[model samples]
Target: MGLPWYRVHTVVLNDPGRLLSVHIMHTALVAGWAGSMALYELAVFDPSDPVLDPMWRQGMFVIPFMTRLGITNSWGGWSITGGTITNPGIWSYEGVAGAHIVFSGLCFLAAIWHWVYWDLEIFCDERTGKPSLDLPKIFGIHLFLSGVACFGFGAFHVTGLYGPGIWVSDPYGLTGRVQSVNPAWGVEGFDPFVPGGIASHHIAAGTLGILAGLFHLSVRPPQRLYKGLRMGNIETVLSSSIAAVFFAAFVVAGTMWYGSATTPIELFGPTRYQWDQGYFQQEIYRRVGAGLAENQSLSEAWSKIPEKLAFYDYIGNNPAKGGLFRAGSMDNGDGIAVGWLGHPIFRDKEGRELFVRRMPTFFETFPVVLVDGDGIVRADVPFRRAESKYSVE
Candidate 1:
């Protein structure tokens, strides 16, 4: 009843050459991705309209697949006969920061994978025959070093060491501070700096990865240990199930405790507010009237409004302007939420102005309207403000 000779061959869990190949491959792919992103960030980034920027909006290798599945679309606007129409859906700063964190995460994971493979190869070699190096000790040292890097990166994001104005939002009014959004203000901390959050996740995963690697290095059980543990045993099954249940309970308890805790504004900067649609509408109306009196088109006047708001946002959110840090020091939030107004305006079939209240849910056709030579709202489109409310708890 014994197994056949060919079937009894040992399964090779670790091969030095194969592991080295995988490590090289992983490094190459990660490096390539990082390089492409760097090029886009530095040489190709366009601050004025990042959505239309070739560098910022360029998709990775997998983007085509996503686009085919109707998951993503080109982030740009259309040009009409009178003026250019920009896509209101795209937010440049948010998009860039998001891409950075995502790529950084991929590289982090690759590093961990390489380390694991190296450790495994060393472990297999040591167990099979005598190796010159102290593999276990070396593996532990590597784990410690990797853990430090992960911790440092995580701390950097948490402290906003990279740049000022990189803050998180606290909608529950946990953080008593408020941020200015150009002509108005709203609650901050709704969206945090992406890198900071990514760093935290990386640190957690890295810690677990290192721990598992170290545990394997420290505990090299003999073949007898595997033989003694019978999978089909009722006692073994009961013990494993009990341990799983306890672990699940611990996770649930920890999540609930964290949720109930007060918002940590100190760890992540204080919450800031932004200008709502009402304020933006008032400003727009004034500016548009002035432009009309001067014989300027609505598109031309509206175009300058964003630029003006952006300048104001910079001044208000600048850490030097009595923010969280000192005047000379740079310690402000990312200011992405400040300068620009949300909501895109379109035209109806009858040439009436249509302001989108919220983000578009699906593809819907809307007419595009243009102001006539006479400084009048084409089709007498009435101006309206998008509703936004604030409260303190």
Candidate 2:
């Protein structure tokens, strides 16, 4: 049976309630970042700077840059763009201008989102901090700008400081869109700080939101969200406080654990690991294939560890147990054509390996010519191989 009605309701309310709380917090942080950036560009820095106008748009901006993220409709496999940023990510596609452009564009918009709130905070509430994840006056700019401040500071830490035309080692992806920015704007810089894709990223952003929510949600002369705990008739106390913390933690863990940050084992678990590993494996496959096209066998090229590891690791071959390979060789003639080259039990040829037994052990031996008897004789060794060469004819 599925569940009782009461149990189902309990599950639904608690889980769904948590989810809704998380979503709101996420959007608020992002929106705050976005709105803050807009205000910063337009009002604080004399105007929306007109140069980064593209950031004004939303997700659509990411479409063209999907390839850099190892994503594409046809998976056209990336190649070097013949350009090098002296301090580029050795493993990231940020080295390429196209991907850099797309990611940078995303960050640009994010920057504007945060900047706009700065203007709001400065203009609206000169004395009070705006209510954000946990600021002072909920409506005041203090909280809003603080979220913006955290994000901006984070972004600056990631992307700025790298001079013009230099490939940045943007570990954090905060200044992700720095490449997309025009040189005229002079926003590009080396951001050695604020690395990205860690569990901490979500945690930090969440904490910022929590702080904003606390200050905003708890303030008197409330914003009637009806989404908070009520301390008094019109006053709202941190209604979603606990949920907010959980939401942030979940977001951090979820994003890191989810597809966004696939570790090496996850991507090439059966083979390679992580996106970088996948890319490297793909490169290896390409190179190995090219070598095989000439004279090399595919077995010598492609990695066999994944295939062998999974099969044998899962299946048993213990002395006390039975397996695909028992005690003796699977083939005849000792199954080991011993000589000077290659494994006696196996072939160097591609596809031929399919016929070879992986579980069986192959062995044979050769004779030591005893001139005293006018002939040669042999002794058996567990790992010996069969002799095939003689010139009696």
Model number with the top TM-score: 1
Instruction: Give all candidates' CA lDDT scores.
Output: 0.39, 0.32
lDDT of 1: 0.39
- CA displacement after TM-score superposition, residue 360 of candidate 1 (Å): 4.4
Report the lDDT tens digits of candidate 2 across residue range 66-157. Answer: 22233212112222232223543433332333444445456555555554433343333345544222223433454455566555433443
Q: Per-candidate TM vs. native?
A: 0.33, 0.28
The TM-score between candidate 1 and the true structure equals 0.33
**Candidate 1 Cα deviation (angstroms), residue 315:** 27
